[model samples]
Target: MMDASVDFSKEMEALTKDLVGIRSVNGTAGEREVAEFILRWLRSFPYFTTHPERAFAQEIPGDGLGRENVFAYVHGTKEAGTGPRKTLVWHGHIDTVGTEDFGALEPWANDPDALLEKLLAEPDLPDAVREDLATGDWMPGRGACDMKSGDAVFLVLLTYLSEHTDAFSGTIVLSLNCVEENEHTGILHGLDVLDELKEREGLEYLFAINNDYICPLYDGDPHRYLYAGAVGKLLPCVYIHGCETHVGQCFEGFDASVAAAEVVRRINYNTALCDGYRGEYTLPPSVLKLADLKPAYNVQTAQEAWTYFNYFVHAASVADILAVLKGIVKDSMDEIAGRIDAEAEKYAKLAQQPVVPPNFQPEVMSYDELVAAVREKRAAAEAKETALDDELAAMAHKLRAKGRDLREISLAIVRELVRELHPTRPLAILFFAAPYCPANTLRQEVAGEKKLYDQLESLVSSFGEETGEQYKILQFFPSLSDSSYLKIDDTPESVATLYQNLPGGKTVSPVPTERIRSLSIPAVDFGCYGKDAHKWTERMYKPYTFGVLPKLILKAVAEFL
Candidate 1:
């Protein structure tokens, strides 16, 4: 048995150093080398076995860099009459978002040992300056947190678990995939291959546990959060083409960049339209880049052409939501294009004028299982909110008469109670409302969005499983805008009517009366990438590491399995 008190500090330091040294940055196609190294290490273990041949490879367009996915497994003991052993998938991606200077910070080359020691000494440092060793705090190198730490944690846990096989109830499937930080193509391809293998061997799996963002320690805090669900991503680009002219002659021809800028402004600043899918739709500022706007004939002329590129990253949006968003983009683009063309035609009826052809491409979650995951999360959230309301009601009675103004005190009491009850509201709401929500919807649309998401997920999963190809999909919904707890309508008769429609949608005997509490968004924020992930000096709130992540993973695994 492995020592429960084994100090992993040293081992972790070494692993981090080793990973940082590899320089397996994304975009550069260096993950293949790292993946090969990881496979060799896994094969060296007596209890673990790598695939019979190369598991999978990472392929980048025009770059013949040989990247690969590594798979290792350990069998479980079975009873005499039992059939095939069940499998538990432990998956992690080996790639990291590549650094600008590929060779700038090779791990452990220069004073890495000392840097590790310094980091260990100040484990509670803030995330911003933690990875900067110049200030005696820093997590040097890329992929430290965005997830080399997660990969190391998996190895450590697996190594320990393998040594104590008797303690495990089922077979372990270790999957170290590539290209997660870029397009997730490596993992998608690996999953396809794994499905083929499963089909050939007739293997059944309980569930796949992805150790992508598993953090063991966090800064000090009482409550911890678990990630029951992750919203899918939908990245689309909008291109606007128009007749460009000199800045001084702006009135002659429509400026494509300016016209595109209007559309972006509408998407960002127009709340009623954008926020209509409250808790579901989020349209952040588009990344506007001048794609093509140059001098015509090498001389300053009023007649010029330009193109504007708008890159949008939408979160948790489903196919229907994407369609709606695309429609909005199309309409906006057409309106702007038409206005520009109309204005340009008035000035000069040039035979060939630039046009804004609605060109939109979506980058979505490449698996149906991911969509089902969001549905599961939504259901879980609904259930949790229901249970929390009950607890808050009980707590409210206890604080009814504490020498405070009843009405004012009740509001304050409810606010505090709601915050306590739904701590994840902020994060969940942001996910649902901003990035995940769709921009367009018919006012008459009713419930069944959840069902729609589940169906889409099932379809995607079925397709992936059947075809052995990866598919990306999205999930969308409406968001509640309020930051406070959802107001529970307290009208006596209305309450009775609400309970009557439970479960079967038919009136139950003796309809119970209860207040209908409104839901509120929680308050949690994640800094941009390169800000929070692993660095030799990376630090997180103690509560996040110890309390939230562990509890979240444990709960998710328990529920999923």
Candidate 2:
């Protein structure tokens, strides 16, 4: 049994401070150090030392910075005749955003006490924010709330389970991943490793509970949520090609940057594309990356420009998202064409020269169409070149093997194939980029879906009914999360078709559709409540996050497991 005399608050606070002090900033040198620290800490436990196979670390390499996903599990003692025990996965990310402009407080980065005092005493801090900090109810640090606090919560749960092995009927599996803020590579690697553990141990996962941080809905009152699904993310990059002209005759040619700007203005923060409403929640589209293609400083107008959007969706299909984006491009193009025609008329009237035919309305082409056109043109000249067909087939095969999206490879192939085939240099084209997370929702009318939903919902609602706590079933997590990999749909073939018909469909890869379909599992986000995550003043509300949330999660685990 767990030691009842132990002060849970102090223990959790110490663990959170230790984790936050490690400075496991993604893409930095400290990530490996933090992973090593976690491994060492896990090993220090007597249970882990006696059964070392129960806990270990798996290294996942990123762009330049490699990371590690730590895992620990405790199996149940129920008899073999009763069937296998269900697993409750507790997932948390260890990586945090970089610390920028820490100012004089940089010295206290490793000392939460000093940092907390500094933050509370800072003159520039807001009165409301400062008052909250002054109450000593918040732990202020870069990753303190965003969410090493959640990690500490899971650690405490694991520790308690180790002492009281019979407290639950099933197993408790914990996964601490990295790179969630940027690439989500950590979760990808963690899931694969988790599968290996499950197969090795002959365990069945009942649910994956991710402890990611959630922002409050109001200032004083924290609106607690139970996310039934994660929002899907898409990065759509558009390349605009324009005719370059000298500054003396700039009005005669279209500027690619201008077109790029118009596209940004049209799509950035446009709520029309946010049609993936489930219940009362929806995540609108926003801008993540935007840039214009310009070679060195010169007097000539730019010929090419590119921009990528941070498009998010839930419950919306690929075709719908594409159609909306295409409409935006068409509108921007028409407006730009009209503006250029009016400018040409003015220039012609002032200079007494014949009006330059305002024939610069660009045609928008999808990445697949562009690549196919290039391939057709190539095959016409050389009848024996079967490389393009082989390449596309190979891409599909690789996607099946890798379980990654096809956007990056497709973008590379399309850029290579179509760069030389652009007869119309001044046209706009849209392509998908790297990193695609498919959205998933639990709301379904199908019998199989409903059965699974009822099983989990019944378990969750029992706790509410017993405690008389009214819990709102949130539509979407409203953020990109690894839980997307856990969802499966009945119409998988249709889903695959939609994916293949997206803007860069030819290059898009299978999204673990097969795995999710075969082993579809329900996931929930029971993360800590916090304010200002990914910001300098990030902090977690101690009372609810540390005290109440764990008990609530424990209730679900007890009922389901």
Candidate 3:
């Protein structure tokens, strides 16, 4: 696929390094800077300058950081008897995760040349990392593997396509998105751009190629792989409120932390609660955040406690997941209820007086129930002035204006609700939070979907055979991506699970569920081969990722077109 005159390997290497040199950590100024640089690179070509409208930046609304998604499309002139042009979307995330993991090398993290030298000389380095450095087959730095290298692939391909537009008979759309490390804010907003573009240009969507990275599961894992679909993710947060009483009257009030701890104990790393599809099982849910809601330390047992877990969605529906979570909460409450009464009884026997044990009863409910309770309470109060929904929306907007991240805003809204409703203590309230990504997998039963996927599998196999490299088409990508926005298997109505309950869902990077499902483009992730992505020792395999993968990508897209 590479032209003899063009130094394809050198082009890839230079482009990758140039992208990595910029410290575009997610949510930083560097993120926007990198996007601007991409814009300049695209418009640098005479072709783009002539057709400036073809390449432009799409601002992601409500980011609060002013980040943008860079888009450039090239049209192929292959004679095809069709009403609308066939289009292929090639997308990559340009923003990288943070550099705090770099430790003392932080100052040079973005300077790959200096970081490489520092890593090679560092003592107590892992044997594998040291060996890879010695071989000089790896390019080490933050974001080098996770995806700036992949962005380089998209940039070069877009350039190649722009130059050779007449050789193929389809359109190619290159999307460089931001904020994949956190909320996937960039691609979520970019979904709007794609929908409008498809309608205005009358282009038929085919599929997307996500140029993320592929790392081994274990040492020396030799197979190169691609993903036909990606797993979904949801953050189910549990907030608990407890009765407050002085230390002298220990049995009079129970601590909310007890129930919170129980929730974590029952849910964290519990494989029985995991979701499975075909033979693929998602990693068990684990707590991403667990903390009390107190502003500061005090003598009184915590008034409220909060925790949230990372739940991967596979074959299970949202309702299926909520039922399991509700069951866990109920079981946790029952066990905690028993403990409270038993402990109170023990204390009474030890003290030996006319003592009255609190024997606090634990209560569990979903966020939806909490909202309903608040509404009922408002109706009883007969405030008659403000609608409950409108008031909550205003409050959420005020919080966003203060610059709190979506997670904090989410918790804050719940806290306000708790205060207004004054829910009974030893209480657990469960709800979804911002940045919910629904899980998606291709349904081969759909018309033409099977043929498209089979064609992709064959292309991967041929590439592997030609290069004498092993490749496997995995069921799930085993990582999070913006690809979730490409196609959705769930009904559009199913979106209410998050929007109706997640605090500030409308403002904090809401998933464009209907738009995504309507687009419904099949997606395949062919990533740059690398190891230890998001780790300090992250490295990309220069020979294959830079030299060979470009040809493979070109061949696959050309075959599809």
Instruction: Estimate TM-scores for all models.
Output: 0.53, 0.89, 0.95
Clashes of 3: 1
Q: State each candidate's clash count.
A: 60, 2, 1
lDDT of each residue in 1-561, candidate 2, tens digit only: 334334467777888889988888887767777888888888788889998988888888423565678899886554242555688888888888877757677777556788988887788988878988888888788888878898898888787777667666678889888777776777766667767767777678876787788776666553566777677777777777777789898777788888888999988877766664535545566776566556478888877777787777666666666677877887887778778888888879998998875667677776666767877888777766677656656755565356554444554455555565765646777776656676776766657655656765675576567655445557568777777767644256546535544443433433556666555656778788788877677788887677767777766766666
Q: After superposition, how far is residue 94 of candidate 2 from its true place, in Å?
A: 0.6
lDDT by residue (tens digit), candidate 1, 1-561 = 234344444454566567656767664556877887776666666565433342233353333466777776665443222554565566666776545332333333223454456444554645546434445323444665555655665565566556666544445666777755634545545545556546654445644544444232344322212221222222233333344446555444444455445546555434443322334444453443323234334433322122222222222223443344446555554555456546655555454745433222212121122223444565766654344334434544444434332222233332343233332211100001111111222112434434433443454455446435343332221111110011111234433322221111111111111110211111111111122453334332222222223322333222222
Better of 2 and 3 by lDDT: 3
Query: Where's the lowest-lDDT run of ten residues in candidate 1?
Result: 425-434
For model 2, state the Cα shift of residue 482 in Å: 2.4
Runs off by more than 4 Å, candidate 2: 1-7, 61-66, 78-81, 220-222, 383-386, 389-414, 446-470, 488-513
- lDDT (10s digit) by residue, model 3, range 331-388: 8877877777778788778878665656666777778888898888888888675677
Evaluate all candidate structures by whole-model CA lDDT and list the values in order. Answer: 0.40, 0.72, 0.82
Ranking by lDDT: 3, 2, 1
In model 2, the clashing pairs are 293-305, 406-509
Task: Indicate whether candidate 1 or candidate 2 has the larger TM-score.
Answer: 2
